[model samples]
Target: MDRVPILKIGDILLVSIQIDMEDQVALQLQEDLAERIVATGCHGVVIDISALDIVDSFVGRTLATIASISRVLDAETVVVGMRPAVAITLVELGLSLPGIRTALNVELGMELLARARDEGVNEDGDAEDEPGTPAVPAP
Candidate 1:
């Protein structure tokens, strides 16, 4: 029944998975993350899995689900710190983990999120301005 810790840094929510992941734990994380995204109005989520040595199909799906939920809440999700073995296992299992962006580490992940925001892009990668908003012509 161990719960993952979700930390808010600036406008981003950082989730570092330090313990073994079980089905119940993953589900709880998904639920908790959704709530945090709404409550904090954060624009990005970074999941650090560097400590984890393995990832099963259920965990992979849970990651994707978390990303989708974050997008729906107007936030972006980035998964970082995936070990090489974990990546191989995921590929071998045919878990493409769609809708999830990855970085080698948290710093890069935050940079990616900042770049997305600076480009006026939403979680869907669409422009964030409304139709009536004035747009500056490209130079």
Candidate 2:
């Protein structure tokens, strides 16, 4: 199986992946990645997908699972560099990654992670459990 590399950018951990292989191989990589991110104790994470070629249900499931685990580890997982085709395919398949954070590229991913680290989650996050929108401080 191909390895997933983790990069630390301040409180954001950027995980570089190249999983264009079969479902088993890809899921294994994602599982290992989740374990490593949890071990790092980072506050935020970005899963870079610049090298990926396709997206399927199993792949979407793996990513969503990893994101859920990362949130538990106090790290927000941002999926970045997703090709337009892949994005459309996931949407068409009705694969909703509700709790997942996304950005266009590594730079933007880091920026969003910083926001999560600074302002915490958006309205879709723990916000609904409470009441009105919480105030956010400038970054």
Evaluated with lDDT, which candidate comes out highest? 1
The root-mean-square deviation over C-alpha atoms between each candidate and the true structure, in angstroms, is: 5.8, 6.9
| Residue 30's lDDT in candidate 1 | 91
Error of 1 at 120 (Å): 3.5
lDDT of 2 by residue, 67-97 (tens): 8877777678889999988888888989866
Per-residue lDDT value at 96 in model 2: 62
**For model 2, where is the 10-residue window of minimal lDDT?**
1-10
Location of the lowest summed lDDT over 10 successive residues in candidate 1: 121-130
* Predicted candidate 1 versus true structure: per-residue lDDT over 1-139, tens digit per residue: 6999999999999999988778888889999999999999999999999998888887888889999999899898999999999999989989877889999999999999999877754533453455655677999
Q: Candidate 2, which segments miss by more than 4 Å at Cα?
A: 21-31, 121-139
Which pairs of residues have clashing backbones in candidate 1?
none
Local distance difference test, candidate 1: 0.90
